[model samples]
Target: MIVIKTMEEIMKMKQAGEILAACHKEIAKMIKPGISTMEIDKFAEKFMLDHGATPEQKGYHGYPFATCASVNDVICHGFPSKEMILKDGDIVTVDMVVNLNGWLADSAWSYGVGQVAPQTQKLLDVTKESMYKGIEKAVIGNRIGDISNAIQVYAEAEGFSVVRDFIGHGIGSEMHEEPQVPHYGPAGRGTRLKEGMVLTIEPMLNIGKYHAKVDPDGWTARTVDGSLSAQYEHTLAITADGPFLITKQT
Candidate 1:
């Protein structure tokens, strides 16, 4: 069953979302060449705790890290490790979730570590743009597929492939909720979006093939051919006005 957030719950979720957004902003300032993904994870854990929020990803289904640091070729669920260090020309993705006062906020961002190749930069640009395009359709009366279609169309037109294995999802108290959000396909199908319905629109686009494989770690996922991949995400709420980005301190 779909849960429509009440005014009070929405406000609570907004506060949680802001905390989640701030976490991402904090990582952006701290991430650079030579830093290990584990270091980033530690920062995230401390920040969330200091801010009175819990890192939902930590201890989530045995996931030990507070942040899922996905480097180039790793799509998502990349466990932060001391061995994985950021370097020049690499794209790093940080996916984090914060739970505050029983509410949850989830978001992700892709960054170009140090200086990246022009083509790699373009991939990052396109991936981020695709996320925004998908968010444009997160309005009342639009089906979930509308958002999926926007992402798929914009990304494909940019000459990139969309990962079919892992998609975005509804997020709330349980972390993962109803309405699985795919990043590729036609609009006007799938679940009908309604007011107060909140979700994450994460588009994982690959510079090579859309296919991916799960690493032996049983969590980290990378490109099947070990090519570059990028992703961006935002927590969205379908509202009477339009799609409201709850992560915007709303």
Candidate 2:
């Protein structure tokens, strides 16, 4: 069933979202050449704990890590490993979530390590904008497809393909809720959105084909064509006024 959050619940989630945002901001600042992704994950875990929130992804469904550090061709759910080192000109994405007093907030962002390639930066720019384009359509009374289509149209026009295997989801007390928010579909289809419904709108765009193959670890997803990909996400609530990004700072 679709979970509708009360204003009180929304406020609690907003607090969690702020902590998640702060975690992402610190992670982004720490992204540079020579750092290991595992180090980043450790820092995030401590940061969340220090602020009274728990790192929700650690041990989630047997997954081992606080943050998913996907680098280059890795689309999402890339395991953070001490062996995985960041180098100059590499683009890495850090996806994370924080649970504060039973409320949850999730978000992801791709960062450039050192100076990246020009085309790679374009891919990142387009992917981030595509997420915002989708968010712009997440208003009350609109179908979820409206948000999906907005992302697809802009990404495709920019010469990128939206990853279909992994889509966004509704987030509340539990991490994943009802009404899967896809990133590609027709504008008029899918469930009609309503106020108080909180969901995540994450668009994963690839510089090449959308086909993704999972790694042997069964978590990390990589582009089949070995092309670079970018992703951005925001947990949002459908308000009477419009869509409010819960993960954004006030």
| Tens digits of per-residue lDDT for model 1, 1-250 | 7778876777788888898888788889877899999998999889899999988888988998898999999999998999998998889999998899889888889999999999899999999999999998988888889999999999999899999999988877878899899999898999999988989999999989999999888998999898999999888888888887878632
Candidate 1: pairs in clash: none
In each prediction, how many residue pairs overlap at the backbone (N, C-alpha, C within less than 3 A)? 0, 0
Question: Relative to the unseen true structure, what is the C-alpha lDDT of residue 79 in candidate 2, on a scale of 0 to 100?
Answer: 95
Q: For model 2, how does the per-residue alpha-carbon lDDT over 140-208 read when each residue is reduced to its tens digit?
A: 889999999999999999999999999999999999998999999999999999999999999999999
Give per-residue lDDT, candidate 1, residue 82. Answer: 98
Error of 2 at 120 (Å): 0.6
The whole-model lDDT of each prediction reads 0.89, 0.94
Q: What is the lDDT of residue 56 in candidate 2?
A: 91
User: Model 1: how far is 248 from its true place, Å?
Assistant: 2.8
Query: What is the lDDT, from 0 to 100, of the residue 3 in candidate 2?
Result: 91
